[model samples]
Target chain A: MTAQPQIELTNIDKHYGSFHALRDINLTIENGQFVALVGPSGCGKSTLLRSLAGLESISGGTMKIAGDVMNGVPPRKRDVAMVFQSYALYPHMSVLDNLTYSLRLKRRPKSEAEAAANEVAATTGLQKLLRRLPRELSGGQRQRVAMGRAIIRHPKAFLFDEPLSNLDAALRVHMRKEIRALHDRLRATSVYVTHDQIEAMTMADHVVVMREGVIEQQGAPLELYDRPANMFVAGFIGSPAMNFVDGTVDGSGTGARLALPDEPSIQIGKRLEPGRKITVGLRPEFLQLASGDEAALHLSVTTVESTGSTTYISSLGEPEIVVVVNGRTDVAAGDKIGLAIAPENVHAFDPETGKAI
Target chain B: MNRVISSFRDGKGFDIALVGAALLFLGIFAGLPLVYNVVMSFQAVDMFSLGTFARPFVGFDNYIAVFSEPIFWPVMRNTVVFVVASIGGQFVIGFGLALFFTLKFPGSTYLRGLFLVSWVMPGLVVGAIWNWILAGDFGVLNFALTGLGIIEDNIFWRSDTAFSLWAVIIANIWLGTSFNMILLSVGLASIPRDLYEAAALDGANGWQRFWTITLPMMRATIGAVISLGLIFTLQQFDLFAAITSGGPANSSNVAQYWAWDFSFRQYDFAKGATISVLMIALVMVASVIYVRSTRHEVRG
Candidate 1:
């Protein structure tokens, strides 16, 4: 939250032969911000991260780091370090050597490199494992070694390309917490890329949602969740992905009504032109089972999944809703359920263009 | 049980028959000759005394005579020198060439094709070509050297004892380098690009990366190339036969050519088989020791 931008990308364009990999992009990140780039695979998120690290060359436009132009700079000269998705640790070198490789390349004294390596290894909780080679270490240990190498350089920024994609589910959750804590302790400017939206929501100071080489929306995590600019962002940001139902707007002057297919009509807070095609977006968490005598849309339950804390009910109806209910809901497969959603929780978009209305 | 028997009777026998045929072919063409050579090495026979089942029983006498000959020891020494020097020079030069080709350059593909000419030519043709170039009087090399004022007189390259060994060594080196270059080049290409990028960020420059990353990663390739090169170089005969014919006081005579001389030229088959058996034993021992020492370095 400062006036100075730590990293700035202006009108950056990248191409692979005739294929445009990254279109014109302009972004400015402030100092010590943890920014996450989230998108589906082949969406150029990793490519953008590599461009920032100077691991890849941009076909056009300017990339600046801390007020200095970084175009045409080799990665070693860019003063930016990257943690690859594969962790890319040198198999032949021990963890200690891997951490101190850069310092040794700078021709620092052996004692100094070893001391610095020990310090970083201790910080990463790898002090006792310094003598182990990459193949001998577990996946989590190898990932820590990769991070330790990046941290030992004390670079201007850190770039991570899907750093935890190879870990098991439990380890991924643990590493995600560790990364957030490390970022907090060091306050380092970092740009991380992943295809996992949950990671982006939990870890980023700001999340950038991208699709098909374009940014759909970029904002604080809750800001994006509450006010997505487009249907794509609304559907991509939430888990059980925001349920979308095709409908048509009906109603006159001051208020509007959504005429859902084979389901109950819904009232809207905003006015809309009657007979226009539209879609309604609702999050699974916002939809729940209605109590006795409550006005709701009746749906036939198709399946029910219960975790310890919450139960999810999938149903067949006009809008085909998914409902997240509180724990201990008496819902089962092949049962009829009443679904209720508030107006404030409903999002409407133009059905023709998928843009938020 | 009936169903299982029916299934087996339906088709599995054909595959077994095909495999049996392959093994039979290998046994006749490969195994039989090796067995015959082992048995022949123990027989005392000459080319002039060719009679069915009437050869004298030599036991270890042929092997003893092979060790007793003064010429045999010198030829063995020469063979060792030729194999070691040629294979070493080929590996170094070929590896350098492979590394050079890995770099981005203009017209590199075409240049690589041009460099493969020596490897593609048959061994006899290569020997003939080098023989014409290294001839004593009108060889292109001496003519070029004299014309350039590098030498006042034409050097009889293949006629002199000192120069003949070097002449054959140079030809063998040229012939062997291309194989090494192709194998090592394939190895270099197979390494992931991300490893190099990671190494670069870790501060490894060209030389450090080459030693720590490239050399260790290509250990299997290097071992295979070197062992095969040694085996091929030890059996070299065409260059020596075409250029020196193991002459000039027999200074450049190698074990393979000496075996041929004993079997064909001197008509002493028993000593020839003995030399062949000794060469095979030496190669097998060297290969086993090398593989054992380097096995730990290679990843599965």
Candidate 2:
């Protein structure tokens, strides 16, 4: 038999007066799974995470942790710990006291609380800094203290609200690795929220892409990257974003050809009705620069940006196209380049609805 | 270095002129009077000799006499009592009101505005209003008490020394509380909301949060309010002048009124200047100690 979910949110809705902040969000996290909610600003990812931790009250719906309803339960009683973006370490408290504050409040024995705090501190490499106040610690050290506070709780679930966003780029990468290692060691169910796609791709077991208070798509990181459900997900999940060319279909059922606005017609694997305007989406990585004698669509190159590993080429058209070529090619501005796009890599969506067809 | 010196020389005259103007104002307004009072406090003079800069110097005889007088110690004691009671009551009640207004409550804004009305009223007006309310004969308080059958007859509020002090305290509490409330309310609002949230998540209950987080966060504001309140309460005069008028044989006489009695009522300017100089010294010492203690608290 399968283990029950450690936390479950059912049909949750949150409203700030007349403004709807979170829609009907239904989610479940099984034991030991790491779920990352990835979205743009104001997408309600942090709000949803706060609600699950009982930091925020939901306007409607039921939240359960370990099979018990959590409505009206304060954050302290929720048996979950959160690491905030700002760390929120008590400025007046020593690192040791900050880690043990919750345990003392729970009426645990003083020795037990101290031992647990020390253990977590040692694990986070903060044992030597236990007596130092938060203001004296570096930003990374403060972040570690925040994480230590969460770990000492032995909570049913862990919530992270952009915990790494405040750190410098190098520290953020280092901390992400540490967090992943900690999760593996603890095997604690965790829900993290972040807007950085790299973070979402690197750390998440399951990525839930949200937009405008609604979940656009949720799947394993690569699955969501490969098969985005709609235009928003297609654009949001990847760096450099998927390029779309507005076009119309020519033939029905089994023989659909996509007519580009400024280039040659292309054949699609799926059938489409004639005269239906559709958007053809292509990831930049799939568009290959072709030679002059090759049978490929011709375009004028607008700009080229070359990194060591890949070169990005922008083409001139009504809806401009960008292509990411592996290994630096000899492409520059005003260069005429031919491009070939694989049919399997193409995504067709209804232009008006922005939905995958 | 030479060029900088030349530039400094060019602007030195204007700077000196500004400094001279400021010094002249201070001499006329603050420094000269303080010097005159100090000199006068050491001299023996009556109202006729007050305008003369030259008077018979009595050394410390005036100070010795004032200290030896029978009414001097009692008036000082009364001033201390009135200041401590009034300022202490104002701090506690004003902080409570500020905290109450800080909460997300219905009609709190309107209530705050209404509370401020007493503070905005002139001190003399407040004293008159309270005097009418606390009067022994034809007073609203006595009438209400008699009508409720709680008392047998009129209570002489101003006649009893202890009751007069308490009555003055009540009026001052009403007038001064709003000042602290406004200042402390601003302080409370300036505290970041996330600190409270952090405290809550750290398992601190309301009282724990208040003592550990709220109080310490508002320490500067509390110190400022208390210090200013003490100073204002110590020098209070108009209320007493309007209401009790140091009535019933000097029973309600505070230091300010006692000094006024010597200077204005008896036309003894020398003794009054002596009392005024002593009051200034006492207030200065209190303020200095307060500043030092707060500085220590902040550093620690």
Best by TM-score: 2
Clashing pairs in 1: none
What TM-score would candidate 2 get against the native? 0.88
lDDT per residue for candidate 1 within A94-118, as digits (tens), equals 8898898888888899999999999
Q: Candidate 1, after superposition: displacement of residue A62 in Å?
A: 1.1
Lowest-lDDT window of 10 residues in candidate 2 chain A?
A253-262
User: How far out, in Å, is residue A272 in model 1?
Assistant: 4.6
Worst 10 residues of 1 chain A by lDDT: A253-262
* Model 2 lDDT tens row, B1-300: 876667557877668777999999999998988988889899999867777888999999889988988988888888888899999889899999999998869999898889889877988999999999889897898899999999997888887875787778878988999999998898788776766776676667888779877887678778878888878897788899887887666777888888898988988888888999988898787788668646743211
Models 1 onward score TM values of 0.85, 0.88
Model 2 chain B: lowest-lDDT 10 consecutive positions: B291-300
Stretches of candidate 1 exceeding 4 Å from the true structure: A1-3, A252-256, A271-277, A291-296, A316-319, B1-77, B100-121, B133-157, B160-162, B268-278, B297-300
lDDT of 2 by residue, A45-141 (tens): 9999988877789999999999999988887677888898988776667899889988877779999999999899889999899999887889899
